[model samples]
Every structure is written in structure tokens, then in C-alpha cells.
Target: MTLGNRKKNAVKAATAAKVDALLVTHLPDVRYVSGFTGSNAALVLTGNRAVLFTDGRYTAQAKAEAAGTRVVIEKKPAVTAACEWIERAGIQRCGFDAAHTTVAALEAMRKAVTSKVRRSLFHPVGALVAALREVKDADEISRMRVAAALGCSLFDQMLSIIEPGMTEIAVAAELEHQARLAGAEGMSFDTIVASGERSALPHGHATTAKLPRQGFVTLDFGVILDGYCSDMTRTVHMGNALPGEHEAYDAVLEAQEAAVAVVAPGVTAGDVDEAARSVLRRAKLDRFFTHSTGHGVGLEIHEGPRLAAKQTQPLAEGMVITIEPGIYIPGRFGLRIEDMVLVTATGGEVLTPSPKAWIQL
Candidate 1:
């Protein structure tokens, strides 16, 4: 969707919420509405007006990117300027995203407005823009597809260089360096390179620990391409697998694929999560399966529509989410299989078209 249409939709939402205006301080929301990708920005959206406030540094950029929106360059903080503008515009109430705003920031914004309108004017609102962003448009899905494809290519390259003696940190560095060379703006998050016993750590960051001669190495990573993010996890054996390791990997793979297969429009997030958890439960490894099945991935690494127990949110078409299932047994071995799936009307389409079968190096 176009930036103007996005702003229109946001304004409609604000009107429905009984808000005269919306003070968009979150950078992503600012970008979504005004198409301004600057570091500092504040956008105020009213029924018929969309004004973007930024510092002097981004005057030209704001004008160039944020078409159909009034751009104002202020010497003070953009958000403070936006609040002052909202008060001056005689808006009765302006809603702000409570999820991203802190107490200190809210206080600052309130101080920017006059005492009469400070308390009542700055209303706190939930994830209004974020909810709209959860459903990806065709353009967003196209960008995310490229990002996921890049992640798959990085994994393929890493498979060739991975060895028994390489330190986990070194392996992570190699992947990141190659990612930059391959045109990634940055890694979505810290590149995970857990080896052997470390594989059991759900978020085990890359460390100096060397890869074991004959154990599992779980690599969980994502890359930022364009403005979207891609995430996936793959675990590979170094030399020979232990007796239970093969069975454990199979269980996780089946669970992950099962969850991915169940991703379709109108499916409840909890049901998709159950599809994965059920596989592990049948194998009696549910206790080892930690963390939720997956979460929405897009402009942000972790977004809404959380796929976990009791999540009643239904999956919508054009939503992209990850289906990652793992069995992490402490001190023995841990393995995860992840895929980025796009929810479709019929069934889900796997964006990460990489090999998930057992890979032993």
C-alpha cells in the first residue's frame, strides 16, 4: 500500500478510537505512514492532515521521501515539537503508542503542551499501526521474500566452511561478514552459534567455545535486507551423531514442518503452535521444547500474532511468520528446525526454501 493510504487507514483508526490526532513517535510507524526512514522523526495524523516533524539534518530527506505529508524541521526534539503542534492545532486529544513510549518520554511530551491540555491531551493507545503492519502487502511480502532468500543463501555458504575446531564466535563472524558482502544492511539480531552443550541454550549467543568434534551446532540467525527482516534456525552435526541425537533432530524437524504446514488463513495462532507442540509431545520431548512455536517476522524481527498456547489471534492472509520447533536437552544436545512461512488462502507458502533434512558435516 502507498504511504498516503497507510496514513489514511491510521487516521480512520484514530477516528474510531475517538482520538482527534495520533502522535506517531515510533520510528517504524513513522516510516510506515510518512515514508521517512530517518532516525529522528515524529508524525501527527489528524483527520485531513499528516505532518512529519524532524531535525534540520533530515529536512531534504523528509521532503523527498514523505510525499503528500507536510514536513517540518524543528530545532528541538521532533516529538516535543509534534506535541506542541498538536496542542496549537486545537486538537482535543492526541493518541500515542503506549507500547513504545516510556514514562519519561510521556512526561516530556506532556510538558511540551500547555498545563490545561497536558494531562488529557496525550492519550495512550495500544498497537494501532503495528496491527496494520502485521498483515504484509504485496510489496512488503516481496521484500521479505528477498530477505529470506538471502538468509537461505547465507546458510548454504556457512555449511561449506563449518568445521569441528572453529569457534562459535568465529563462525558467527564469518556469516555476518558474508551477509554484509551479500548486501544485508545488518543482522536482524545477534547471530546465534551454539555448539554442543551450548545448543541447549535457546538464545545462546555466539561465544569463543569451539565446535565439538562430534556434536550438534545450532545456528539461529536472521538478516536485515532493504527494510524487512528474515529469521531461521538450522542445526548440523560435526562428525557423527549420538544415538538419541538423530531421533531428536527428526522429531524437531517433523514438528517444525507440521507447524509450517498448518499455517493458513483463518487458523488460530494457538492451533498452529499446537501442531508443532503436539509432535514433540507425542515423542515425549515436549518438556524439552522451550519457547513459543514462532512469531510474526517483518520490518521487526519479533512482531505480533504470537504463536503460542492460548493465543486466539487468527492467522490472516499475507502474514509472514516463522515456524520453529526445537528439542533442547541440557548437556546432551539440542536441535531446531525453522522456516519462514507466508499465510495463504489455501495453505502456507514456505519462503525459506532451504534444505531442512539432516546435515552432517
Candidate 2:
């Protein structure tokens, strides 16, 4: 959606929440509404006015990047400027994202205004713009598709370079270099290159550990492109895999695919999680499957509508999420198969449709 539409939606939400204005201090929220991708920014939204506040450092940048919004460059902190502006505009009940705002930050915001308005001026609004951002627009989906494609191509390149003796950090460095050459703004998160027993750690980042001659190498990474993020994980065997290892990989792949198949409009996020968990449960690997099945992805790597047990949020079209399932057997082996799936009207479409077939090198 256009920036104007986003601001309009935020205003409508603020109105519904019984607030006259919204003070957005979160950088991502500010970017979502005002199109300002600066490091320091605060966006104040009302029914009729949308103003972006930033420091003097972003004077020209804010004006050029923030479209269809009023840009106010101030010498003071952006949040302080935004709060003062709200008080001057006669806004009494301004909403702030309490989830993102800390106690000290709130105190500073309240201190920016007069004592008469400080006590009752700011209302707690939880993730107003972030909730709106959960559903990707056509433009956002297009950008995410490109990011996912770039991740898949990087994985393809890594397959040829991975060997038994390569250090995990070296592997990650090469992958990151390739991503930069391919035009990624940055990585979504620190690259994960868990080899052999290290694969048991779900978030094991790239270290100096060397790849084993015959064990699983889990590669979990993502790339940032055009202000969007893409996440996917694939585990490959270095040399030869035992029969049990092959079975475990098969089970995880099946579980990941099962979860991807259930993604569609009107489906509950819990149902999607169960679709994957049930597969692993049948394989007697449920205990090894840790973490949620997936989460909404867009401007941020992790968003709302999380796919996990007892989560009642329903999936909607235009939401992109990851379907990742794995079994990590500590001190033995582990493998994860993931795909960036876009929720569609009919079902789900895999954005990262690289080869998931068994790859032994």
C-alpha cells in the first residue's frame, strides 16, 4: 500500500483506540508510515495531519525520503520534538507503542510536554503500526520475493563450496560476500553455520568449528533487500549419512512441507503449527522439535501472527511467513528444512523453492 494509505490506517486505528493522535518512536514503525528510513525518526499521526520528526542530521534525507508527510527537523531528540509538537497541536490523548517504549523513554516523552498534560496525555497503544504491517502490500510482496530469490541463489552457490574441512566462519564469510556482490543491503540476522554436533544448537552462529567428514551442516541465514527480509534454512550432509540421519532429514522435510501446505486465508496460525508438529510427532521426533513453526515476515525478520501452539490468529492473504521444522538430537545430529511461503488465496506459494532433496557432498 502507499504511504498515505498506511498513515490513514494508523489514524483509523488510533481513533478506534480512543486516542486523538499516535506518537510512533519505533524506527520500523516510523519507516512504515512516513517512508523515512533514517536511524532517528518519530512520526506523529492524527486524523488530518501526518508529521515526521527527526534531528538536523536527517534534514535533507527526511525531506527526500519521507513522501506525502510534513518533515520537521529539530535540534532536540526526535521523540521529544514529536511530543512537544503533539502538545502544541492541542492533542490530549496521544497513543504510544508501550511494547516498544521503555520506562525511561516514556518519562522523557512526558517531560517534553507541560505538567498539566504529562500525567494523562500518553495512552498505551500496543504495536499499532506493526499490526498493520503484518499484512504485506503488493509492493512489499514484490520486494520480499526478490530477497527470497537472492537467498536461494546464495544457498546454491554455497553447495559447491562446502567441504569437510571448511571452517564455519569461512563458510559464513563467503556466503556474506556473495550476498553483498548480489546486492543485499545486509543480512537479516547473523549467519548461522552449525556443523556436526553444533547443529543441535538452534541458533548456533558461525564459529571457528570445522565441518566434519560425515555429519549434518545446518545453514540458517537471511538477506535484507529493498527494506525487506528473507529467512530460510537448509541442512546438508558433508560426506555419508547414516540410515538414522537420512530418516531424520526426511521427517523434518515432511514436517516443513506439511506446515507450508496448510497456509491460506482463514487458517489459524495454531493449525499451521500443528500441521508440522503432528508430522514430527508421528515420527517420534516431537520432543526434538523446538520453537514455533513460523512467523509473519516483511519489513522485519519476525512479525506478528506467530505460528505456535494455542495461537488463535488467523492467516491472511498477502502475509509471508516461514515454515521451518527440524529435530536436533544433542551430541548426535540435527537438521532443519525451511521455506519462505507466501499465504495465497488458495494455499501457499514457496518463495524459496530451491532443491530440498537430499544433498550429500
Residue-level lDDT of model 2, residues 1-361, one tens digit each, is 7899999999999999999999998898899999999999889999999999888888899999999999998888989999999999999899999999999999999899999998999999789899999889999999999999999999999999999899999999999999999999999999999999999998989999999999999999999999999999999998888769998998998999889888899999999999999999999999999899988888889998799998999999988999888888898988898899998889999999999988999
Candidate 2 to truth, TM: 0.99
Q: Estimate each model's TM-score.
A: 0.99, 0.99
Q: Which residue segments of model 2 deviate by more than 4 Å?
A: none
Off by over 4 Å in 1: none
lDDT of 1 by residue, 152-231 (tens): 99999999999988999999999999999999999999999999999999899999999999999999999999889999
- 243, model 1: CA deviation in Å? 1.7
Name the weakest run of 10 consecutive residues (lDDT summed) in model 1.
Answer: 118-127
- TM-score of structure candidate 1: 0.99
